[model samples]
Target: MFLTVTLNAALDITYRVPRLRAHSTHRVQEVDERPGGKGVNVARVLAALGKDVTVTGFAGGATGAALRNLLAADQRERPNHARLTDAFVPISGTTRRTVAVVDASSGDTTQLNEPGPAISPAEWQAFTTAYAGLLPRTTAVALCGSLPPGVPVGAYAELVRAARAADVPVLLDTSGEALRRGIAARPDLVKPNGDELAQLTGVTVPLRAARDARRRGAAAVVASLGAEGLLAATADGAWRAAPPQTIAGNPTGAGDSAVAGLLSGLADGLDWPARLSRAVALSAATVAAPAAGEFDPSTYAAVLDRVEVAPQPHAA
Candidate 1:
């Protein structure tokens, strides 16, 4: 089973507008809400793909309750799919909410995110306890998203250690100081977008720079290059995976869906090339969907054959 850890849970709200103009009033055609946060997104995608997944993290206040209710609803909606294991822990602070405004004409998205609630030390302890109890059953642990206020930057590092102690591989996806500290723990995998990769490795946007990041401590690095697809470096070798072409749709949560594909592939004992293919397929499929963090299974299957994986000579 895969264990997904989200430090800051959220209710993601998305609105679709005809065209987004600065300081201009626009009529929204659609508005939707879902349980979100990076790890939760990963779990949701994995569950949709028939993987045994569990989500653990903080939830509090009315927003937290709503997020939990949404997850429960998802479970009920897909009872035949893999079940969510018990790992969600409650805390004192209310969870956060994120908003995305998508321009229908341009397919561009502007996002606003809350910093999330400040977690207490006691709440941290409760989360740690719950994580420890779940590690034994986890085949892989994915630590995702931003850290809440009052949570130390090294929190992901601590979770990495716990997963290590339980003989479980860990994947970390975050940005800024949290990512900087988390990488020091040397998690098995780290997925960062081009900008985040540049920030972490202090290199310009290039494949060589991403490879340098792997040398810095990431056992393997998967850099999401927007429409360019994924650039990956692993102990086995370096490779690039790209879809046939970019698809137009909502781009929100595509990275998280890619994480789910990566973890699911690893759990299924897929080779690096195969894993890359799955990741690329899932990411592109996500972009073809109208909802954030969701992909049509049919679209995913159709794109799987179109994903191209080629070796990088410099990756070694």
Candidate 2:
């Protein structure tokens, strides 16, 4: 089973509007609410792909309760996708929420996110204790999303070390200091977007940045370059995977879907080229889905072969 960790879980809210303006009143045509956060989003995509996945993190208050309810609802609605289990740590504070405003006219999406609640020392201990118990069962663990207010910046590093000690493959999919420290822990894989890669390694080029990140103790680095596709650097080799064409929709959780693809492929022992093809195809299909963390099934099957995986110019 794959495990996804989200320290700051959230209720994802997506709003559909005719058009978005800088400062104007507009009525939203529709709204979608789902359990979200980086790890939760990754788990959602993994489950949709028929992977047995468990999501663990912080959840509390009414929002947290509602999020769990929605997760249960998802299991009931799609039993064949995969089994999604909730193992979140309960906190006294309310979980956070993220808002995505999509302009149907231009097919553009705007996001407004709130910083999650600050966790307590006791809460952290409780989470770590439970996390230790879950490590052995995880084939691969995804340490995803932002660190909550009270959590340490080195939280992901701690988790990575624990997973390493257990000989379990772990993937770090966070940004900022968490990512920097997590990379130092020598995870099996690190998936970062171009900007995050640049920020961590100070390299402007995606390929060079991914290589630099790999040098910083990560076994491999997959840099997500939005529509340009994924640039991956591994011990085996480096490759750039791109979709046939950019499908415009909601790119909200495209990165998460890519993570799902990579983890699933890794579990299946697929080569880097095949793995990246799945990542790029899943990302493009996610863009075609109307909501964040969901992929269009038909779009994914059609785009699978169109994804192009080519070697990086400087890397053999």
Best by lDDT: 2
Q: How many clashes in candidate 1?
A: 0
Candidate 1 off by > 4 Å:
17-29, 104-106
Per-residue lDDT for 1-316 in model 2, tens only? 9999999999988899999998899899999899989899899889999899999999999999999999999999997889999999999999999999989998778999989998999999999999999998999999999999999888999999999999999999999999999999999999999899999999898888898899899999999999999999999888989999878877878999999999999999999999999989999999998666789999999999888899876654
Question: Candidate 2 lDDT (Cα, whole model)?
Answer: 0.92
Q: Count of backbone clashes for each model?
A: 0, 0
Best by TM-score: 2
Model 1, 1-316: lDDT tens per residue?
8899998989898889999999989888999889999999999888888888999999889999889999998899988778876367888789999989988898788999988999999889889999999999889989999999988889998999888888898999999999888888888999999999998888985588778877778899999888888999898988999999878877778899899989988889999999999999999999998677788788899999889999888643
User: Would you estimate the TM-scores of all the predictions?
Assistant: 0.95, 0.96
lDDT of 1: 0.89
TM-score, prediction 2: 0.96
**What lDDT does the true structure give each of the candidates?**
0.89, 0.92
Tell me the alpha-carbon RMSD of every candidate.
1.7, 1.6
